[model samples]
Target chain A: MDERFALVGLCPAAEQAAPKGRRPGKRPALAAAFLALMVLGCLLFPLLLTKDPASMDLSNYAREPDGTFWFGTDTMGRDIFAMIWSGGRVSLSIGFLATALSTVIAVAVGAVSGLAPRWLDALIMRLTDILLSIPSLLVIILLQAALGRANIASLSLVIGATGWMSVARVVRTEVRQLRTSEYVAAARCMGGGTFHILRRHLAPNFLASIMFMVVMNVRGAIVAESTLSFMGAGLPLDTVSWGSMLSLAENALTAGAWWIVLIPGLFLVATLLAVTELGEWLRRSANRGQSNL
Target chain B: MCETLLDVRGLCHSFPLGAGRYLRAVDGVSFRIRKGEIFGLVGESGSGKSTVARCVMNILRPQAGSILYRGVDVCDPAQFRANRRMLQTERQIIFQDSSSSLDQRMKVADIIAEPLAVNHIVPPRGSLRAEAAFQLRYVGMDPAYLDRYPPELSGGQRQRVAIARALTMEPSLLVADEPIAALDVSIQAQIINLFRHLQAEHGFTFLFIAHDLAVVRYLCDRVGVLYRGKLVEMAPTKELFDRPLHPYTKALLSAIPIPDPRRERARTRFHFDEAAFDRTGGFVQVSPEHFVLGGKEAEP
Candidate 1:
């Protein structure tokens, strides 16, 4: 009788479980392939393509697309093809680094704030509210100006520092919810200290949320870098980045050399789309994995 | 009488509801559990039974109280910290919700071995898996469940795993806060029987908190009735059921339906007068063993 009841209860769950085990969908695979190709191109293009991005050839200046140059030439006669790839490496690196730094700070602050006492939680949350209220773009521009330069390192730092409030808020909420979970309380009753409970129970349970924040932060960082560069507060003029290219292309666009603006703009949009798609796929897979477990 | 294993005196706890207002969850509650005895705390939902258990486990810092575990005042911050590790090893808790109590990500073996690993209780080169398997068997579960996650198990099986995990600590004082409340009625009996068997075999003290008066009568040696964050009555299991002194106790006891329809229909349900009972007076002893709150004053 008990076995029959158990089977009856498990039938619906088993049926629900079937879909999770099915083969991966085509869209996620395409997204993953696209992201992988983009990442690989960004990493290798600057090294393999020997065309100098800074060298000037007056005869080729503002030339249209031809057999010699795949993306034509900019106003300075620099190969737009070489410039795009080289700038991609810097832009991608900034996105990756800034997201990593922000995620680390956010996780630490969120975990502490959520798991700490009422006073500490209130203090951290109030600080987060203050930081969140300020316009992040303004903060980043001011920080860039104060730092005296907008190199990759300082640009990444500025974006990372200003972009952590939302991530912190997300992590704090997740950790607070997990803190009240019976498993966490049980861990405490089992002689586990605060750090042990946080590391073992709370951290693993909330990893999907952290991964989500990481993806969002990366996209935000990329966009913020571009916005700053457009405003002349991101990477210096000599530095190669998608944002820097976009900044330089404004004049080229006015002169009717559309390829210079259009090529980099397409690359920027494609990269962001690929990242967003891949992040969505990853989060869905993570959810499926948890459900299966 | 057996030596007192846990003595809680005037324990009070409250939660802030914002705007300088406080909701008192436990109001000056006091009780004691004898060594190797199952002392059940019975109350309706929101009656603060769990709060009292949490206070006894030192999970919640009570506003004002003294909890003496084996004669050591666990409520004192300095003393608790000084012996925190030892105290933790000696006392463990089992929550009501089996699904929420066990970490879903952890396998049965890891969950069971967690306490042993955390307390550094395992011997050098000792196999945690072996100990976990042993605990599983002790709880009448197969060793095959070692690799299974909590989600894979049924409610009863999950609760059994929770019991196995708590047993791994070999604690002297186990605070089971409605451990069987979430299980199906059919499964509740099995878990309760398992608890009774284990308690007898290990001779460990248990603070069993439950809302079911029948289950408490079946498992606990002594039972305390709680109403509105206060103890209304306390006596040995049989005496408390046979002759409940307090009006709230009478109401609670009468609420338990009899199995036979004829007797159930004829029974008069006791109605407790909440407004009539004054809260200013302390518990008055009506008999040598039983204590009742808000009872008639003793005659000269």
Candidate 2:
């Protein structure tokens, strides 16, 4: 791959010690503040929810919080705040784990397929396109229906399998651009194998895009999980979630007991908003990396 | 007698012309590059000059012919893969656009050290930083630049980093494909002089490929002219310039724009139409080490 036609080997010694100019931005500060708050709030859930979320009280059913229960009671007399906290772990885990797993798979597959020879690239891209054409929700639903009764793992698998296409596409484009660069050619000249180059150079260089995609994918996974749970296809009935809470309270909305749905809905919206904001921040940073010239 | 380090024989490459037709980019091009000498490849755009360089680098596989290094054919995939480490250690390349060529994610030190690490020429667990710094110094860069990214550096600096990376493995032959084309004219001279000085100091063989004849004239010991994937002429620089056997070479020489406005006004530019020679075959020798493809030898 000795594609390098000319090499420049002289650096300006006089300017070597000069510091690079910095661009001003407050985005990092905002992101740090939000993330810190989220960590604190999430970490306190177990300590806050001492009682089992499914524990029922026939006597205090639908009682508003006055002294004991802080967020009032559901139709089964379970605490609303306690259920939200207890259920947060599963939803957050599904979102983070599914996104991470899918991203890793996409990066590996895309980098290899993208950097492969023309025929291989064509084959991989065609397969990717076919996969992408299948509607995500429908695919998840089909897998769940075929498998019969989806658990958290199966739900994550369904979401992750369908969610990889966009990441793969993004990585493929990056690898294509990078393959034309001289360093990759230089690496080839140095007897670095295909996998070696991908692992050492291509993967590292494509990190900004990969990170941005992962952040966005996490948000997407969260929304997908919520949707599946809302439709009664995600998690079991024993598991409590923001979506399940809303599903249960949907019938009682006209009975003047609006607190059951309102609280969980607000939490879901807030969580989604926070994740979307984080994704935007990551995307901005990735864009800055791309515009380094 | 010079030892031939690179021997390119009967090399031909082509792509689909369209509608089941194919166009040959390099046809039966045969030449030998000697160790410790800079061989210049000069041609206009679409002349397949760069294609020849690409073929030698194994970036683009040729349709026919053999590229031999040290008396072994490298066109075979098995042989090429088996001897890849040796090939990389023996030969390296620099590109036209330094910015596009350099990996933006890498720090100056890591970029320079990549060749050494990839080749395993140096111990992996040992102090690569110290060795990288020494190599950087050899290329006129200071130790302070080890941490800076490519985007933080200027064009010339980036190119320097690129060169440093190529040289880290101590390759005996370097292929430079218009190294200074992307830089400012002022910076071009500096980089060109740097290359000349480095070649002289290290005694490294070079295949200097470029479109600028003037730069080729100043830097190369011997020059070869290519037209549409065929070598039209090859001669010592002085001999070729003084008495160009090929009409194409003559036309090319006449086209070098004089840097000075007054000199430009005083000079006559040669007119050339590429289509006029389309019907002709490949190059034929008219003098010792000099040739032209077309039949025309008479002055216009």
Best by lDDT: 1
**Residue pairs in candidate 1 whose N, alpha carbon or C atoms collide under 3 angstroms:** none
lDDT per residue for candidate 1 within A141-186, as digits (tens), equals: 8888899867888989988998888888888998999888888888
Model 2, residue A227: distance off in Å is: 1.9
Q: Could you tell me which residue pairs clash in candidate 2?
A: A4-B93, A4-B94, A5-B94, A5-B95, A5-B176, A5-B177, A6-B94, A6-B95, A6-B177, A8-B160
Candidate number of the best TM-score: 2
Worst 10 residues of 2 chain A by lDDT: A1-10
What does candidate 2's lDDT look like per residue over B46-140, in tens digits? 77877788888888899999999887677889987788778878888888877777777778888888877776676343678887787667666
TM-score of chain B of 1: 0.97
Native contacts conserved, per model: 0.54, 0.59
lDDT of 2 by residue, A143-245 (tens): 8888787777887888887899888988998899888777787678767778778887888878787787788787788788888888888876568766677
Question: Model 1, B1-300: lDDT tens per residue?
Answer: 779999999999999999999989999888888999999999999989999988888779999989999888999989998989878888989889888888887889999999988988863326999999888877877688888788888888888888888888888999999999988897898888888878988999999999998899999999998888898888999999988877788889999989999999999998988897666668888787788776573321
Q: What is the lDDT of residue A55 in candidate 2?
A: 83
